[model samples]
Target: MASASRDEFHLIVPNESQSAEVKLGSDVTIPCHLSPEISAVDMEIRWFKETDCACLYKKKEVIEGRSYQGRTGLSTEELNKGNVSLNLREFKESDMGVYLCQVISEDRTEEIIIEVEERKDSDGQPVNQSSKIQGRQVHLILHESNRTWGENQRMKMEESALMTEFEVNYVKVLHQTIFKVFKNQGKKLEQTELQLKESKTDLERVLQQLETITEKFGLLENKKDLDMKEPQMQQIEKQLLQITKYTEEKQNQLEEKDTQLENMSKQISEKEKLLESTIKEMETSKQQLEALRQEQMRQQELLEKKEQLRISELNEKSKYLEETKSLLEEREGKIKSLEKEKDRLNEELQDKDKRLKDINAKLIQTVREVEKKQNQLQGKHTQLENMHKMLSEKMRRPENKELEASQPDEQETKSKLEK
Candidate 1:
């Protein structure tokens, strides 16, 4: 019996590692498998709410309880074949607890667990809240919650007063620093001016000495003055030669400028003609573009007119289609009526054919009866003719006998009288 009970019962439930969460008011399926060695025939199965220790089902029937009524079911057909899965419908938040499936055999029991979860909103809040985070106004509340103590009204007032005091002290320090820097810069500027003036005086004395040497060389024409101060005169002559070369370069540049001016005048005249031609081409292009734009506008108007005509035609076609549909519906009704009449006539024809076949059968029976009576009458007629013929022959035989007797008697009488 223990072995028989072991073969008839098995446990089906989620293991500790196989548990999953399901939202409330949704459908859930708990997969359970029976041992292959066990047959579910004649075995009692039960689903128990493990948290409250309440029975959910027993022997394929739902147990009546507030916690388990109308909530639990099993695939009974599959259960007999060792599939021990439960189907739970319309789950509730109160169902968020462990569940156990208990199978009772002849001598043993088995159990399993299922976990349920309550439903949550997209923002992870409970669904029953009036001010859900999904609402637009809830963002303002969240923003207000994010403010720090340092950013509050009292802290701002304290920080402003402190900042004003610090600014006054900062301005006083800045003014002192600026005044010291300006006094030092003024002393440095005076020394720089004295140095520049002294350098300028020294440069003017040197320039005067150079001018005297240049004038003396310009007057001298003797070889004795060039020999006694030949090096000095050569230096002065080099300086004058540089000045002359620079002056000649400036004169050449002026002549090149005059030639460039003449060339520019000729180029300007050609460009003016080209500009006039370009202006004419631009005017022609403008006229062509204007004509093209007018043509485009005319074509657009024509297109609009064509579209309007097409729309009117489509409306007419729609009206015609509606009329045709109504006509088709009427024709269909007429055809249906005609078909019904045809069916009635066909039924009547079938009835007439049946009657004709019955009448023909009756006529054939009556003709057969008449033929039997005619055969009996023919036999009676033959018998009556034979009896009449026999009677006539008998009557004639007696007459003939009487005549012979009378003739014989008369012959004898006459013979006697004559004798």
Candidate 2:
């Protein structure tokens, strides 16, 4: 599987060593050039350490990770030309490691090693030397100022002059280097400060927006409170059910009473035409039956009116229920709309959080760079002081040697006079 995967991927890095050296407290680029150069615009380029512990880019925009946040980026201008170099700021010993740059679009990957070493003094030596004498390997003796000694002195003088000239040139180069670094640091610091201020303002604005969203949510909650409660609707439905049951019972009773009255009318018609002997008895019975009929008629009228009143009341309650249902439907729609709005606000809030994180990372990286530069400046200052002290000691040595040489000549002349 590994072999097959390797065959599908091709990237280019320096063949020999692929190692770039950088001094501590400085910035450096770890190059990962593309083979068969082509425009890499919009390509997903990722720079990572130790198999992707830190991510430097997702595409054109840099992706800040815990380790490389604010400290790593690409040159936006060069990206179009296929330059995928990872630029790391404030190089330190901790940063000396292998980094990989993978081009996801092209399915290619490359690695570069960075070596971070300490900065040397102006003389290209360690800066902890206490005195110039510690650097000397041998001592010299003085003699008379004769022709041979003078020739030797002249030769030494010429060598000293050459050494002085070289030291001066070295110091000049060092001065230029320090000056350029300082200038770059100043520009970076100013840029960082400006970005920090802008980010602070943006964070404040986002907080305000979040507060507004919270307030709107509170208003929606209050509206929900004012709407009809579900428990109340249930209670109304139960009352309607009881009324329908009672009305059905009353309708059944009225239907049974109508059937009974029809049967009795048939009996009365048949009996009225019976024999003359039974006519008198039937008259008495008819009179009593007529009175009962009058009473039943009155009761029927009252029941009919009561039934009509109940029907009307039922209809009115049903109408009210329908209206309440419509209102509930409308409220449901409104609640749905509010929910959608809330979701949209949540998405916006998430986006703002991501922006804030990116800004914070940049700020942190900038502060680190500033501190590194300040330390570099301090080191340079110490180096200059050491160089100045060494130069003064050198000047004093030559004068003291000349006095010793003159004293030797006087001693030889006094010995000759005694002889």
* Candidate 2: segments with Cα more than 4 A from true spot: 1-9, 15-21, 106-419
Worst 10 residues of 1 by lDDT: 136-145
lDDT of 1 by residue, 135-155 (tens): 212111000011222223233
lDDT agreement with native, every candidate:
0.56, 0.55
Q: Please give me the total number of clashing residue pairs in predicted model 2.
A: 0
lDDT of 1 at 344: 99
Which candidate has the highest lDDT of all?
Answer: 1
Alpha carbon lDDT at 342, candidate 2: 90
Residue lDDT tens for model 2, 174-271: 55765675566557556655655565565566556545754755645766642544454355456545545544554554454445445544544454
